[model samples]
Target: MLKAPDHQVAGHQARDGSLGPLVDGSGHFYKPLQNLDRGSKELAFYTSFNSMNGIPPRIRRFFPSFHGSETFQASDGSGLLPHLVLEDLVFGRKNPSIMDVKIGSRTWYPGVSDDYIQKCFTKDMKTTSMSLGFRLSGLQVYGSEESGYWKPSKKAVQSFTVEDVRLALRKFVSSDVGWASDKDTLPDCSLATRIYGGPSGVLAQLIELKEWFEDQTIFHFNSCSVLVLYEKESALRGKTHGAAVKLVDFAHVLDGNGIIDHNFLGGLCSLIKFISGIVAEANKALHGLESSADGLELH
Candidate 1:
């Protein structure tokens, strides 16, 4: 969803297929020197401050500064926040910059020599398909010793349903990214996280706005590059009784698998708006319908 420059995220379409930085699930969009020597002190040193532009300061304080900042555009009518910029995006007063810090223990892309996590993508490339369902629930990182499957931990992955998906995704992301939400108040923290670096309490809150276009939707993260989500408006007449899952195509979005599409960006902006409408309607539907128990435990 990143738009053209001065405000948009800086990205390069790598020949191999990634979007640039560490390679996407597909080997194409490669992050520069993402693979540094293993156990390298320098890599640890830099991550302490590198923002990657979105890492919260509390977390970022644990890493190093980024080499430079980059910009990406916000949605329409974003006004003052129209452009989201990585810190030091314009830090060129011939400043010493992150690069000159002297990587005494190593170079860029630390932990290079260690055997790569070696993701066994389906294709010759290293990408696979995953379902990104409603509510962003239960989303967890799973790896296979043999690249055979995305075996979700049994205790973690449960029956796949709209509510199930939403709850899991909400919990998984909130915990990893450090956000929280109400039990039934699925706020879109994925977007909220973008507006990072504010007070911790505020930054960790979700917009809870699922107000994009109507209809529940499902996203197919086939590959890291091309993400596709689909939801039908309504069935014409002859369609099957069982509701059909729809598909939206976005080829080569990140690698050969992602699609940072028009709808994608729009969805992020409109989610908050949509959720507001849902909450309003739910309240009207019944008293005490809203639940606030769904959240990541702050251990």
Candidate 2:
């Protein structure tokens, strides 16, 4: 059976009269097709991306595996619609923490209408996107099944500062912390070493993606989001089954025409730098604890 995604942290959502993405019990995500131009363009990009042999195998894992398209009845009673079938990133997780980070200071593409550019520009300036090269669209952190998910209001997220962005990244990987009450204080960041510091962690994966973005000029991903996800349950158990980094939202993707994608690259690097700092701080904190423990033993 298909239903609305409970873990979706951002973007368009299903409402009274509108439809959003759907997930099946079989671990498949179904995204409703947009307008003719955008829907077809996105499908083409995925098809072409998967078919191309030159795309490095290591980088390909960063994208959700596409399973083509399927026609399904719309949730809003708008009849049938075509949906893109993809791997459900949070399908099997018991308690998943997901964050959607939209890369690039500019979201519009070349040859777009002036009005569209202006709209995007205004929003970018209003948020951290313009200055920091990226913005946290939205996120949900697992706070136990009884407590439910902890997410900030849309207005609060829009008003976030540079420090707020860094804190959000740290909070995303933290556990059992009061996100709202402890806004000014730092979380334990105990999961930092495991979730963002290790070989298969988010930091390493992002650096790998950055390396690919540095050279690839085949496509310019406009307004695309990098989803950082991990299951709190699995992470606490010291398992890596649910940790991943996946690129999503291809409606505005454009042909690169051999030019470098400086916008996306710059934003990705900014995110990486922030993560690297967090890992370093977490290591120092751990070292401090160890030293204190040794001092106590000597006494």
Candidate 3:
């Protein structure tokens, strides 16, 4: 049966008076189509992307495996609607922590309606996107089955200052019990380093994606999000924490033809810097902890 996705971090949701994304137990996600122009553009992008040749497998891995589209009974009781059938990124994961970071300071592309551009401009100015080149669209961290997920409100996310954004990043990788609090607390850097600093970590993967964006000229992604996921339970238990990064939401993708995607590239570089800083900080903190333990043992 198709049901509301349990781990959706951000976007138009059922509570927002719109049909939200759904998931089937068989490892597929169903996103209800948006307005005509946006949905058609997204469909076209995926259809083209899936069929294109010569795209490197490493770069392609950064995108969700597109399985085409299908009609589904909307979870909101709306009639049957055509939905994009995508690989469910969180399938089989227990206590998953997910984050959606929308890249780009300007979400609207040239040639969009003036009113639409203004709308996007206003939103960009109000959120950290204008300054940070990216904004935390939303995130959900598993606290416990009893406590449920720790999700900041949309209003709270929009109101995040630079420090709050840093803390939010730290909180995502933290296995601490006090993670749900709004205040800043130093995280145990082991989990952060393990999940974001190692060879296959988010930092490494994002740098790889940045390299691809630096040279590619096939498409310009506007309002696209980088979705990050890791298993919180596994991280806490010292198990293999399945961490992943993928690009999603192509409603505003534009043909690059021969031009480079500077907008997306700039935002990606900014995100890379943030993740890199976290990794460095985590490493320093971990080294300090080890040294302190050694000193105590000597005493």
Better of 2 and 3 by lDDT: 2
Residues 20-41 of candidate 3 have per-residue lDDT tens digits of 8888888998888886688878
Computed on alpha carbons, the lDDT of every model, listed in order, comes to: 0.24, 0.83, 0.82
Instruction: List model 1 lDDT by residue over 1-299, tens digit each.
Output: 33222211212323243323321121122122222232132233234324245444443332213343232222232222211122222122111100000000111122223332233221112110122211221122211123212224333343444345434323321212222323444433332121221123111222211121122232211211111111111111222211111111111112212333233334333333333333333333333444321121111
What residue pairs clash in candidate 3, if any at all?
none
Root-mean-square deviation of every model: 20.7, 4.7, 4.7
**lDDT rank order:** 2, 3, 1
The local distance difference test score of model 3 is 0.82
Q: Residue 10 in model 1: shift from native, Å?
A: 22
Question: Which digits, one per residue and each the tens of the lDDT, describe model 2 over residues 163-228?
Answer: 889888888878766664655556678788788877788888898899899899999999999999
Ranking by TM-score: 2, 3, 1
